[model samples]
Target: MAALALRGFGRRCLLARLGPGPALHQTIPMATTAQEEMRRFWERNSRSGRPVSPHVSIYKWSLPMAMSISHRGTGVALSLGVSLFSVAALLLPESFPHYLAQVRALSLGPALLCSAKFLLALPLCYHSWNGVRHLAWDLGKGLRLPQVTQSGLLVLALTLLSSAALAAL
Candidate 1:
C-alpha cells in the first residue's frame, strides 16, 4: 500500500511537469459551434489551396463510370415513378378501368401512345440491364477495364432492344 501511494505521488509529479491534458486545454481554444468549426476548416483549406471535397469536374469520363452514374439515376427515376403511380392510384376517385376508358376515349394517335410507352420503358429497361451487369460484377466477373467497357456497351444495347420490343407491344 505504501509503494502504491508512492507510485501515485510520482505520477502526479510527472503529470505536473508535463503540463498537458487540463493544462493544454487552458492554452488551446476550441470552437463553440459546428458552424465555427466548419468556418475554421474552410479557412484552413482555402489558405492551403486544398480542396475540401472532390468535384466532378476533375474526373475523366469513362464508359463504366457513366454507366454507374446512370444506373443510380435510372433506379431513382423508376422508384419515384412507381411510387407516384401507386399513390395516384390509391388517392384518385376514379377506378383503374374508368381511367383506362377515359384514356381510350381520347382516340389518341398510336404513334403518340407508342412514344409514351417507349419513354416509360427506357428507364426500366436500362435499370434492369445495368442491374444485371452489376450482378455479374458481384459474381467476380467483368472486372477488367475492357470487360467493363464491353459489358457497359452490351447493357446499353440490350436496354435499347428490350425497350423497343416492349414499347412495340
Candidate 2:
C-alpha cells in the first residue's frame, strides 16, 4: 500500500512538471535518493570552489577552544584507560597486586615513579576540573568570554597543582 502511494505521488510530480500554466509557481515536494542527494552535494560544492573541509590550521587558537578539545581528549583517554584496565583484570591469569609486585621489583628510582604518578594523575585532574567547569556552564554560569577564559585558567592551575600533589605521594 505504501509503495502504491509512492508510485501515485511520483506520477503526480511528473504530471505537475509537464502540466499546464501556473504549474511552475505551484510547488511539488520531490523525494530524493541518497545517491542523487550526494551527486547534487558534490556538484554544488565543486561549483562553489570551496574546500571540502574548513582550514582549521589557518584559524587562531583560543584558550576556551583549546580547553574544549582537551576536555574531549582527556575524556576519551580516561575511558580507554579504564576499559583496558578492566579487560586486563579479567583476562590476566594473575591479579593486579601481582603486576604491582612485579613493577615494584624493578626498584625504579623515586623520580621515575613520581613522574609516572604525575602522568597518570594529570589527565584525571584535568578532566575532573574541566568537568566541573562544564557543569557550571550547564547551570548557566561563566558563559561570558572573560568568564570562560578565567575558568579555563583556573582549571589548568588546579589540574597542575592536584596532579603534582598526587605525583608527590
Backbone Cα, N, C clashes tallied per candidate: 0, 0
Off by over 4 Å in 2: 1-53
Q: TM-scores of the models, in the given order?
A: 0.68, 0.69
Local distance difference test scores for all models? 0.90, 0.94
Instruction: Compose the digit string of candidate 1's lDDT tens values, residues 31-110.
Output: 37899888888899899986655664566888888888999999999899899999999999998999999999999899
Candidate 2 structure quality by residue, lDDT tens digits, 1-169: 9999999999999887888667667778789888999999999999998677675545678998889999999999999999999999999999888999999999999999999999999999999999999999999999999999999999999999999999998
lDDT for position 86 in model 2: 96
- Backbone clashes in candidate 2 total 0
lDDT of 2: 0.94
**Native RMSD of candidate 1 (Å):** 9.2
